[model samples]
Target: MRPSASVAALLLALIVPAAALAQAAPCDGGSVFEDRNGNGRRDAGEPGLQGQRVSDGERIVVSDAQGRYRLPLRDNRSQFLIKPAGYRLANRASGLPDYWLNVRLQAGPALKYGGMPVATSCRDYGLIPERRKAAGDLDVLVFADPQTKTATDVDYYRRDIVEPLLADRLAGRRVADLGLSLGDITHDDLSLYPKLNAVTASLEVPWLHAPGNHDLDFDATRDEDSLLSFRHVYGPDTFAWEEAQANFVVLDDVVYQPGSKADYIGGLRPDQFAFLESYLAGVSRQRLLVLAMHIPLFDAAPGRETFRRADRERLFGLLKDFPNLLVLSGHSHTQRHVFHDAASGWQGAKPLHEYNVGAACGAFWSGVKDAQGIPDTTMSDGTPNGYARLSVRADAGYGLRWFPARQSDSDKVANPYLRLYLPKVLRRGSYPSRGVFANVYMGREDSRVEYRLDDGDWKPMRRVEQPDPAVLAENARDDETERLRGYDRAATATPSAHLWNAPLPTDAAAGEHKVEVRVFDPWQGEQRMSASYRLLDTAQD
Candidate 1:
């Protein structure tokens, strides 16, 4: 479970996950898998990923206005192919795109899209303070690995995503004053940074970047040019910047500590650590210490170890004194939030909420064509490819709403895709593994939920009444699950989003199925979402 190119290439060379592949319809395109931001679901906005080319040997296509693309491969290819030169793929987590991907092809044509999350396009960085004692309302934009392997990838991000963000700024939204890229901005092309920054200049924001494995020189006779090219483009590797509300501390954790430059881990070297300490010396305790690293402090399922124990401990020690420390990281492009509950996390009392933001590239932008024939770049975890806007509220509360690329084109603030409703699960209690659990949010409590599994009978999930503590405490806690659970629930912005609990009758034969659930709200038409789960081997019959 790691996000590395070698692992991806190796997995592609070996196991093409059956779950991620599908059959095909002849030259109908060998099952092109692209980010179909159509239907206002996950399209790109100012920073759209346009002009990406997808081919499966027989078919070829490009991205469109919806930040979508399509392609068809001839023969028995199980997966729709990805063109690696100009544009690599993206890996998204909970709701943010990072550096991993999951793709499905049409019909029997199978394609295996695998890899560790790359800190290429989606990234992190410390904000360089522009003013002191100034208006405290500060908002920083975080872009993870875009992994522009070629000029096209850059163009895609420029047209599909960044340009829209610029438009948002023009619209008076107070777009983030500062910008930070996670890593892998350039895919081995040390020469791409200046041009990349040039396009990023569209936002009219001062930006900072981190180096990823792809951005490094794998084979250098000497270490002088380790990140020499990077320094030439974005300046020092590890440093601090200031915004009004938060004191940003960035660390270059991509130190190739073990193998020269070719093979390294997500680790920070002595010099980088020293820079962090030196930067912290001047930071005040009241100011939030936001550590933005290219690699995740934790991980997603396929996302493997990046930030190790020693580094976690070291970083924890560094920020332990500060009461407000926010860790913004990406690498595991699986959008999920892990709040350092008192039970699980690195250290300290305050919950360290780390986000495994999904990829803008959506599993390397791999998948079959949708109604528009563009790649359905929804990641394996089911998160659609998209960017995230993190607003650090003036009240010291962080407010985040992940905007699907498709949403920027429309004016509706909340769409059906953004709602979540789960059933009541016993608080602090475990349920029988085989029992059925329900999550329903049908706008109103009276709306119904219809469920079906692999030709199984349609089942009705009953709505039960119960007191929801999390729901009640949401708005009360700035850093509560409300800001974070959006990924798990897709929508339902308010605390009334999700309600989950298991029923006694949820047993089945040990097998797999397409469990599809559709909920209808009074305002919107019926909305459908699906999840696949294998019956636990130890499940009680």
Candidate 2:
């Protein structure tokens, strides 16, 4: 990412404080205590609540002695903030927000937020990989960048998003799947993780964690410097597991790399790279690969509003091999779709799709207020605070749906296909000899779609009949055949009448007009999606 002049100047200022004064060093975590009633400082009875919790996004844990705690301790993105209870924070000197401990320890070590303290590896600490399988049919309550500066800010997450999804994430949604906070768990306070988790767990789903840059060791000098306390508590940062028709790989790529002044870098470590390669070797091509991380691959090239080209290119090079890759990332805080194509790869097929899940925090956790006076929580790119769902099939296909927090019914469809047609006019010369092409993958086969155009009334787009008689007879003879295997309802082996070649309304005029495609599933009850396009004049009209 290109460096911002303003940010560079600010760092320079931080490195060289305007007025230098020696400050008192508090306890293990720090001395940033809440006054509860906004008093001057901590006093008797208003003790800094002990045993508080903290998180980065992927991990969760309680505070330790001295009223401080580290979360998902081992994750590289472990930027911990104190989880303050019954209190809140104004902001930090970073101007980035509240105080967060950047674990990329290069700055040095700290009993507090000054820098990262080194320790023997987990092997040296007796920690090892615990062969664990995440719960089944798991409902994961994923919150991306819940960066809150004040308690009021936390309420927005608690009221608008979390409160509504509580029932679903706990039982109604996936039933057994757990919930996860993607990153930027809190604005800054390593202290905030606990208070946040306390409120989040009220939904009744166990929360996994991941750290974010905002949650990092701000005092770090080098990239390797990190919040060792996070590792000591949670497990390691990189890990894997299998579920339904997919295998999940959660990576910790937000490594604050070493730079001239002090900036964060994104990358995969040598050990993590090895770990991923090993995980990939055993997975079958038939299964879907879901790679979840905080940063997006090149920010999906979302105009110039994304990450640096070099970073994206580097990330793409690292993980473009798999046949079935579905990346779920959310760094830019916007919902974006990125596509990558490799001439030749192991699985051998079409290019890959990377989806950048907007944000649960939305726009660094700032925006307009809702009825509850909480900011609207809209993401920087105008997407609402929401989560995504992927329904996997017995076969190699999956259906994705995005749900906006403000809606009751699933009627909100965010990713409607953008329909593009070739040749404004269907001239006799260009018309396909086979008629026309119609792809019926309107999200799902069972979806009910009604269509209309400049003057024609709304009519349904039906899923017509399947195989030819001869082929059906042939398949009846053999229980297992390639043709039979590919002829399932979702997979059409042979084609017939085309949907794209609907007669261009013989009664229609030749002026510019509109063609509307309305799609919905009565079965889903509400979440119907629609798309519209312009129609050019018909040469022969």
Candidate 3:
């Protein structure tokens, strides 16, 4: 039936306004602006930052001339900024960088550990202008596998690792410009995220983290839902950041298979590759491209594939154009370097370098406790518990140095580069079969190691494939005892990648002789250490 003009007009007005409201309200969007007053809000007079890049995990969009951007709403995903050089994001009170916004679901997956929280309206990002040094000066603090299992483990990390670094910062010493934790932030207990973040935040640097196997939600039935807790706490599991020296990408390489026998494998998802292909195309090849992840790209053991080979080939193909590349990973707990060539599907201009960093909680914080109530926690490969310092320079060059957790001030010969083991006494004029061993912490297969006795001619030390004698000795001690050494016994020794051996010349003299050892470190120049051993006459013995 035909209605009157007034009734039809009223119906048209009601339907039209409702449709307009539905279209006008956007689910995801915000403005990138210069926070002139240092506050995180965009007040009057604050200008929008033009040409800034924002991403919704897969797709990237540039801010318009007015510094505004809008992306299609992605359910249960995160949007992050590709921070530009010379500008910095303000850190949250928890010391996490304010670079990402969470687009969460009203009701996320119900997991054993409480899943993600409801969505928040935190799209607006405030950037502060920072005067950075010329092209390539950057320093980063690198930590791996601080996999604390309980409150006590957290306390150990706080006292053993964080306190020393915090002391340096408190004393007005220079700290790293950026910090990275390569995963296993917690040991299966997702609730410890806040406590761990608090300790790391005390460093006062912008920190980024990769997801490790331990940082998973076991109740999820699929790989896609594995990192719900991680994303909730740490934002996007895959994202990128930029500096004058390098373009950094953090990827979630751990692929969970809820019901599979293998449980999980190391590989990138298609979405991660999509983001990489889109973003890397625009990235300048002149700058270093640094990829950080929890699992390594290379296989852990021969003939056994740890990471998916097809995914690695695709990733390498995307990275072929970049000349300067570095890959950082941490999952093995022990440290080593791997170079990928053509055989490994790396067809770059040169071999690809991967540094598998040592764990901060070495051997899961196991071993006898010291006087400070901290575990010794030396790794099975004989690498002491420590962190890495990465220095980048202007010419696309970088340097890496490892610092052990405990440094002794009173020892006459205190060198952090390597640890030495030698017998205190030997029979004079014997067959000279006993040898001195050195564990060069950062040593490579091609490293040049030499030793000199009593300041005599320097003799070369041969690299050996064996367990570190020092660690083996400690293992023996633990085995000979019945009582519990600590929370756990030290890990049994494994063949080290950097152990060197040299025969001691007991035939030289009957008195004490000083042995000096040195190695030419590719990054840290020359490092030296000294120890003394005595030779006794048969009658005197």
Candidate 4:
């Protein structure tokens, strides 16, 4: 039999020191209760919830039969709830889920961006019960590398990215169940966190954040204190959450090495590993396990490793038992899909899929201004600034779709998934050396792409390793002009992972020929676009 609430309170008071009774005590905790009255607080007759999971960054604890939990507090660490599947947390003034309590250091090192502000203890965590729905697909909104540097950038993010989604939700369109930002939430300016949070919270979904290299406190002497500001604003740097379709884990993979030649390296800490081992031991393998971070697990350069190899091996070993798994990362502004096999130390049943999502502020928000006074911000790989929608099925399989920040109204081919570049005029009988290029934004190497000329039989397009002509053209425009295009020039073109080419057919009798391109997207299925090019009669000239 469990002790009564009053008796439990008395026991806790007796066991805990008097000095630790205050809100900022070294050992602070309270009850987790069902908010039956719909108020944010626990009232009379409100029953305490047992078996709720809570964490103090490093260790996880469960509530007793009386719905009570206690944990030793660490300065600058957060106490956050691991939200269960069928309950919802009360919302704070910012409209974000009130799932965390920030604990600040009484006397800490001064940071360039102010460290965490003083906070009172969150004694009671009030969770409202939610009706259980029939198991179905789960949709999540994913944003990576917002990397906003200034207040102006935050405004652009609000107007360009947040508003449209908010409007869709307001208009009764299907919206995501939750949101996740893979990291680089700001560009070294931690002060913009609140503003960014406010804009994101307007959507009214709980948002989970992973800390990026840019989100660090450079002034901190050691790696442990690098995310002081981030922890204060967002909760734990590494944590987990549960949903009907999937189990999500967000990790702070950036390991700050103060005064080293490289400021930071992508890796996990010992404490994070301990937490993961503990949490994953009890996780159900029937659902998909998703690990979200700011750094890609694969190396960026051939011989040089971006993420620590040893840590990757250890992580892969831990995840080997989970059959359904996905890894989401940001940091490379360009987007691509990676499959981990034996060569990369993955010993899973199948190749592990890692989607390196494109940045929200494409190329550091650099490019010419649009009519709306926002930067073009196209990524170097020809993928536009955007976010991704991830859908997880009941079977634990997942699908993804990329959404560009804005679509070009003037595009001859209005397809959102593809952009094509073709010459305006070509000689009627010219050698078929000139080819039409296609940039499939969400394309993979295995993706099937083909083109047809004037309703002719389709010809397969060959995947190529070359810079995107569209972005190359933009680079040429910036280089040729003496005047500044915008606050900063567009990113220089890099060899795209998703580009394809097929020669245009010039032998056919032509005035204006319609070239249709179609790609079989892995998730979105078939997508098609059409463009026209005129044939020139040189004799007339």
Residue range 275-347, candidate 1, lDDT tens digits = 5565566556665666777777663223455566577678767766667767776665445555654343455
Stretches of model 1 off by over 4 angstroms after superposition? 1-136, 170-173, 221-224, 257-262, 299-305, 341-345, 368-375, 413-541
lDDT over C-alpha atoms for residue 460 of model 3: 97
Off by over 4 Å in 2: 1-108, 111-141, 169-176, 227-234, 258-262, 284-286, 299-321, 343-348, 394-396, 410-541
Task: Return the lDDT, model 3, position 23.
Answer: 28
Ranking by lDDT: 4, 3, 1, 2
| Backbone collision tally, model 4 | 0
- Residue-pair clashes per prediction, in order, are 111, 56, 0, 0
lDDT tens readout by residue for model 3, 1-541: 9989989968967866855433223545588999877677888999998999999788898888878988655666788989987788887766798888777646777997876777746477788888666554789989999999999999988888788788668989756788999999999999998999999998888899999999999889888889988887888999999888888999999999887889999999888999999999898777788999999998988888899999999999999878899999999988888889998999988999898899999999999998989999999988889888888886779988888875522335457689899999999988888889999988987899999999999999999989988889999999899988888999889988889999998778689999999999999899899999999888743
Q: Write the per-residue lDDT of candidate 2 for residues 1-541, one digit (tens) a residue.
A: 9669989867766865543212111124343344454333455555444444344433434544444443322323443333221233332222121324433323235535433344312110001111334322323445567766667667767876677766655555532244555566666666565566666656654345566666665565555555343333333455554444566666666777545443655566666565555445555666676677776655333353234455445555555555667776766665655555552221235667666665776654444344566554444333456766555543546555556664544434433222222234433333332211123222343445555665468776554433322223333544455443221211112432112223334234444445555556322333323333333443653
Candidate 1 residue-wise lDDT at 326: 74
Work out how many backbone clashes candidate 3 has. Answer: 0
Across 145-248, the per-residue lDDT of candidate 4 in tens digits comes to: 99999999999899878887876679886557889999999999998988999999888777889999999999999997899888877878998888878999
The C-alpha TM-scores of every prediction are: 0.53, 0.53, 0.92, 0.92
Candidate 1 residue-wise lDDT at 86: 21
Worst 10 residues of 3 by lDDT: 19-28
Q: Provide the overall lDDT of each model, using Cα atoms, as 2-decimal numbers.
A: 0.50, 0.48, 0.87, 0.87
Per-candidate alpha-carbon RMSD to the true structure: 22.3, 18.0, 4.6, 4.9
Give the Å shift of residue 433 in candidate 2: 37
